[model samples]
Target: MDKFDKKILDILQHDCTLAVSEVAAQVGLSTTPCWRRIQAMEKNGIIRGRVALADPEKLNVGLTVFVMIKTNQHNPQWLNDFGQIADEFPEIIEFYRMSGEVDYLLRVVVSDMKAYDSFYKKLIDKANFADISSSFAMEEMKYTTALPVNYL
Candidate 1:
């Protein structure tokens, strides 16, 4: 991508709600060219999607838990089943298969201890686990959805 494209991306990543004209103005481009660049980016999958950020505290899901999971069954069938199980729970916002001591990791958000207890029971019932440990996030020091565009 060129400098104009990088600039456009940087601006859009910060606030996508701006009109194409406004973005064009910030990037020193006319409406047509700026709009075309955005459309091209979307078509090429450079711009994946746009979304509104929500406040977890306002949503009553302030508790963030990092769950590290280990399982004896590491076969494909077990992983497929676990994926389905993970899909069933909305509390699991992010899930990943890891390469270290932990087999898998999940970032879960919930209301409180009572809610987490209910989720934990449901999870254990749905899957087989050799070990599962959790660490609660006391504070979110830094968080951002924006990605650096300097490499572009």
Candidate 2:
């Protein structure tokens, strides 16, 4: 990717709603080349899907919980089953298999303590776990979807 491509990516990362013409102007490129670069990026999978960022408070799910899980079962069948279980819940937005002390981690959002309690009960009933710990986020200090393009 060249300077023009990087500039286009940076601008789009900030506001994807901008029209192609507007982005072209900002990146100092004419309409055709700018649009072509964006198309190329999308085809190559550098540019993922565009989405509107929603307000969690307005949606009535402001509480964020980081769940750290440790499990004794390390077989592929157990991992696949756990993955399916995680997919069953809309509250689980992010899930990951880790390399450290924790076997897995999940980021969940819910309305309040009552909602979380219900979710926890269902989660425990679905599978067996060695340990599960949760930490509530008191405040979001910093959050952004934009990624740096300098490395490219």
Candidate 3:
């Protein structure tokens, strides 16, 4: 991608709601070319998808829990089952397979300790885990959807 494209991406990353004209003005481009660049990025999967970042407190989901899951199973079938279990819970905003002591990790958002306990029960009921360690986040210093434009 060119410098203009990088500028366009950086501008869009901050505020996706900006009009093409607004973005074009910021990046020193005409509307059509700016629009074309965005479209090309979308088609190429550089721009994955746009979303509104919701406030956890506003949604009654004030607690952020990082669940470190250890599992003995390492087969495709087990992985598929784990994927299904993860997909079943909307509270699980992020799920990942990892290397090292933790086999998997999940970022779970919930209303309270009680809610998390209920979620834990459901999770254990659905699948098997060798160890499930949960750590509640005290504060979120930085949470952002924007990736660094410098990487491109």
* Candidate-wise lDDT, in order: 0.97, 0.97, 0.93
RMSD of each: 1.1, 0.8, 0.8
Q: Residue-wise lDDT of candidate 2 within 1-152, one digit each (tens)?
A: 99999999999999999999999999999999999999999999999889999999999999999999999999999999999999999999999999999999999999999999999999999999999999999999998999999999
Which lDDT tens digits does candidate 3 get at residues 14-132?
A: 89999999999998899999999999999999999887778889999999999999988989999999999899999999999999999999999999999999999999999998899
lDDT of 1 by residue, 16-70 (tens): 9999999999999999999999999999999999999999999999999999999
Pick the winner on TM-score between candidates 1 and 3: 3
By TM-score, the best candidate is 3
Count of clashing pairs, candidate 1: 0
Error of 2 at 27 (Å): 0.5
Which 10 consecutive positions of candidate 3 have the poorest summed lDDT?
143-152
The model with the greater TM-score, 2 or 3, is 3
Model 2 reaches what TM-score against the true structure?
A: 0.97
Error of 2 at 83 (Å): 0.9
